[model samples]
Target: MKDKRDFRLEIASIESAGDYVRDILKQYKCTDRDMVRAQLFTEETMVYWTETANEGDILQINVRKRFKTISLSLSYRGAQSNPLAISDEEEDETEFSFIGQNILIGLSTVTYSYENGYNVITFTLKEKGTNPVILIIFALAAAIICGLIVNRFAPSLGPGLSASILIPLSKAFFGLLNAIVIPFLFLSVIASIFNMENIAQMKRIFRILFSWFLGLTAMSAVIAVLAGMIYFPLQNGASTGVNEVNIWTQIAKMLFDIIPSNIFQSFLDGNTLQTIFLAVITGITMLVYKGRFPVISKVVSESNLIFSTMLDAICSLMPWVIFICIFDMLLSGDGRVLLSSIAVVVLICICFLLIVLLCLLSVALIEKQNPLQYIKTIGPVLLIALSTASSSATFAPHSMIASNKQGIRDYLANFSIPVGALFAKPFVVPVLLLMTLFVGNFYSLTFTAADVVSMVLLCVILSVAVPPVQGMGIFLFTIIFKRFTIPLEGLAMAASLFMLFDYLMTTGNVFSINISMLHTEQRLREKDKRVIVYNNQKC
Candidate 1:
C-alpha cells in the first residue's frame, strides 16, 4: 500500500473524489470510522467547491497515511474560501455548514489556506494509541499465563528471574515516577490554583462553585472511607510497626506539617502537605499581583506543561510496567494478592456508581429535574468519557449536552465544566480511599481515626492535582503510597488494575461535574431571587 496517493477530478465529479479517497484509505487499513470521515470530508469539499468554483475547475485530492496520522488534502484552483465557513445569507446552508464544520472538527483537524493560486483544505486525524484499557487487559492476561507457566515448570527460575529482571524494571519505573512526583505535584497544584484564580470575573460564581466543588469532594471522601470500612473489613489487630498515639496528637501533627519551615527540605523530602501549602501561598500571591508577576505566571504554567508532558511520556510505558509488576507478583505465587486487586477494582466501581447516583438524586431533589431523563440526555457523552477515558475528548459533547439539553446557562456550563475537568475529581476520592484500604490490608497496616482524616484530606487535595490525563492516575498512587507509608509493592498491583478504575473514574468525574454545574446554577438562581426581593422591599 502506498503511503500517499493523489486523485484529480472535475468539480462536478465529487463522487469520484470520494470513491478515490475511500479506496486509498482502505489500502492504508484505516478503520471504517476513518473511512467514513474521509468520505464525508471529500463530499463536503465538493459541495463547497461546487458552490464557489468554476464548473470545469480541477479538484486535486491527496490522501496520505504517515506514521499513525492520516492526512487528506483537497486543492482546487479558486479564490480563498473556507469550506467550513458558515454564511448567514443562506439560512439552511448556514445551518448545514455549521453542523458539518463541527463534525469535521470533532473527527479531525481542519485547516484552510491559499497556496500558490490554489485554495487548499486539509484534514488530519492522528490514529489514537491502543486503548489503555485493552492494552492493560492483555498485559494482565499475559502476565498471569506466563507467571503460572514459570511457577509450574521451573520454580527455581522464579526468584532469580524476578531479582535479576523484574525488580530492577519495577524500580526503574518507580524511579521515573518519583522523579516527577515533586515537580508535577507542586506545579500542577499551583497551576490549578493559579488558573482558578485567573478567572477573576467569575469571582461571585467562583465562590459558590468552588465551595460546591470542595464540599462535594469532601462528601465523596466520607462516602469512600465509610464504604471501604464497611464493605472491606480488615483482620483484627493485623497492624504491625505503627505506633499507638493519641488521636488529638496525630491530628495536631498533621496540621502542623502543612506549614513547611524549610521549603527546600520539604521538596527534597517529598512532603506533599508542605509542598501543597507552598503552592497555595504562591498561587495566591501570583493571583493577587498577576500583572506584576506575569513572568512568574508564565514560568509556572510552562514548567507545569513540561512536567506534565514528562509524566504522560512515563505513563505511556504503563502497559510494560503492568506486565512486569503483575508478572513479578505471580512469579512469587502471590495469586491471592492478584485476587485482592480484582476485588478492589470491583469495590471502586461500586463506589463510583454510588457517587453518581447520589449526585443525580440530589439534582433531582434540589433542582426538580428528572434524573432518568437527564441520564438519557447525557448518556452518549458518558459513554464517550468511559470509552476514551479522556475528559478532553468528552468536553465538547458534555458541554453541548449541558447547555442545549440540560438547560444550564451557557457561560456557567462552559466555565464550570472546564474547571471541573481540571480540578474537580469527586470520583477520585473513592478510588484513592478504597485502594488505600486495600494496600493497608495487604500490608497488615492499620490507620487510626486521625490517619483516616488525614488520608481523606490529602486525597481531596491530591485529587485536585490529578492531571486530566488518561492512565496517568496510577502515578498519583506513587505519591499516595509514599505519604502514608504503604508498601510500594501495592502500587504495582494497583497499576495493573487501574485501567478498570480509570474508566469508572472518568465517567463518574464527568457525571459529577455536570451535576455541579446544575447545582451551581440552581443556587445562583436562588440568590438572584433573593436579591430581587430585597431590592423590591427597599424600593
Candidate 2:
C-alpha cells in the first residue's frame, strides 16, 4: 500500500512522523493554515498511537484529500485500546495528555475504530470549501427569487408546468431514494447488529437516542394536544364524515401489523415498519444462532456494499431534485398560506434543534473536544437535509462528515446513520403532531385524553416506521387524521407548508445520530483498557 494516496510505514520509531505528515499535506495542496493543523494533529496522533503500540508493529497512514477536506487514516496493530477516545476526566493522567489535548481531540475531527486486528484512527480537518455555507446561502436566495417569480408573474404557468413535469421528476427522484433506502436500512441495521463489538455499546447509545426520540415525540404531541384544547377555527365547513376508529381494535391491529406472515409482502406493500420489525427479529435470531448462518451475514454484507454504492450515485442528483421540489412548492397557490400557518411548527422545531445543539456541546465538552468541530463536520450535511428535506439525500454528506469530521468509526456511523435515518427519526414526530393539531383546530374538533395518547404514540411509532421522504409525512398525517376523526381538509396545506420546517427536523436528526456515535466511542474507550495496535505481517 504505497501510493501517493497511501503510505506504508515499516519503521517502529515515531520521530519522522511529523515531517512525513507535513510533506503529505504539502503534496495535497492543503492551505498553510490547514497544513499547520494537519501536521500538529498528525504528529501528536502518531506519537500517541506509536507509544500505545507493541514493539515492532508496523504503522500506516493513508492520505485522502477531497476538495476542502483532508483525512489521515492511520492503521496499526498490537493493541486494541482506543486511548484517543478517552474522556475529559481521564485525559490528565495519560503520558500523552498534551497530545490528547492538542491533537487527537483538538481542532481536528478524530474518529477511532478497531477493524480486524488494527486500530484505524482518522484525523480530519476542513481544508476550505468543506462547509456548504456559501452553497446554502446561494441556494436559499435562488429558491426565494425563483419561487416569487413563478408564483406572481407566471403563477398559472409555473403551477401547470410544475404539476405536469417538475413534480413527477421530483417524485421519480424520491422513488430512486426509496428504492435504495429500504434495502440500505434493512442491510445496515442487520449488519450493525452482527458486527457490534459490544452489545452494551449499542444499548447505551440506543437508550440516549430512544429517549430523545420519545421526548421529541412527546413535545410534538403535547403542543398539538394543548393547541387542540384551546384553539378553534371557523367550523362552519367542518366535516361530519370523519369517524374515530375503535382504539382497542386499532392497538391490536397495529401490534398484529408489526409482523407479517409473508416477509416478502412487507417489501411489496412498502410496509417499512413491518420490514424493520422483521429485520430486527432476523438480526437477533442470527446473532444468537451464529455459525449456523454464516453465509447469510456474508450475503447481507455484500448486498449492503451494492446498496451503498447505489446511494452514492443517487446522492449526486439531490441538488436537481431539490431544485424541482422547491420550484414545484413555490409555484403552488397555497404556498404562502402554508408557510405562514406553519410558522409555529418551524419555530418550535428550531427551538428543539437548539436544545439538540446545546446537548451536543455538553457531550463534546465532557469528551474534551471543541463542539464547533462537530458542527463543522455536520454543517454541510445539515444544509443538504435543510434543502432537500430527504434523509436519503443527506446520506453521503452525513456519512462523510460523521466519518471525517466527527471521527466516528465508519462502521458505527455507517450502520447508525441509515438505520437512524429511518428508525431514529426525531423530526417527523413534531411535524406530525403539529399537523394533527392543525387539523383539529382548523376544524374545531375536540380531543379526549385517549385521542392525545393515541396521537402521541402514533407520532412516535410512525416517526420511527415511516421513511421521511417526500409525501411520507402527509401519508402518516392522513392516517392520524382519519384515526382520530380530525378533518382532513388541512392535510394538504399543513403538509406542503412544513417542507421548510422539515429541514430543521432533519438537520437536528443528523446532529443527534453523530452525538450517539460519539457517545458510543467514548464509552467504548472507557471500558476497553487494551488499545491494541498490530502489524501487517500477522493480519
Question: Residues 1-539, candidate 2, lDDT per residue (tens digit)?
Answer: 12233333433344466577778777666555456556656566666665566556677767776644567777777667563444334322242234213321232145556668887776664443332333333454566678888677777788579778977776676556656655666765565455432333446445654555455445545655555444423222223333244446645666687788888887776665576787778778777776566467557756754564465455444444545555565776434543556555654555475556665665767677777766665677778777755565565566677667667666555556655665566655666766676656545665544455556676776676544433454456555665566644454445454554566777777666666657766766664544333333346
lDDT of 1 by residue, 90-137 (tens): 554244334433443332145566668888877765444566778888
Per-candidate Cα lDDT values, in order, are 0.73, 0.57
Using all chains and alpha carbons, the TM-scores for the candidates as numbered come to: 0.75, 0.53
Estimate the TM-score for candidate 2. 0.53
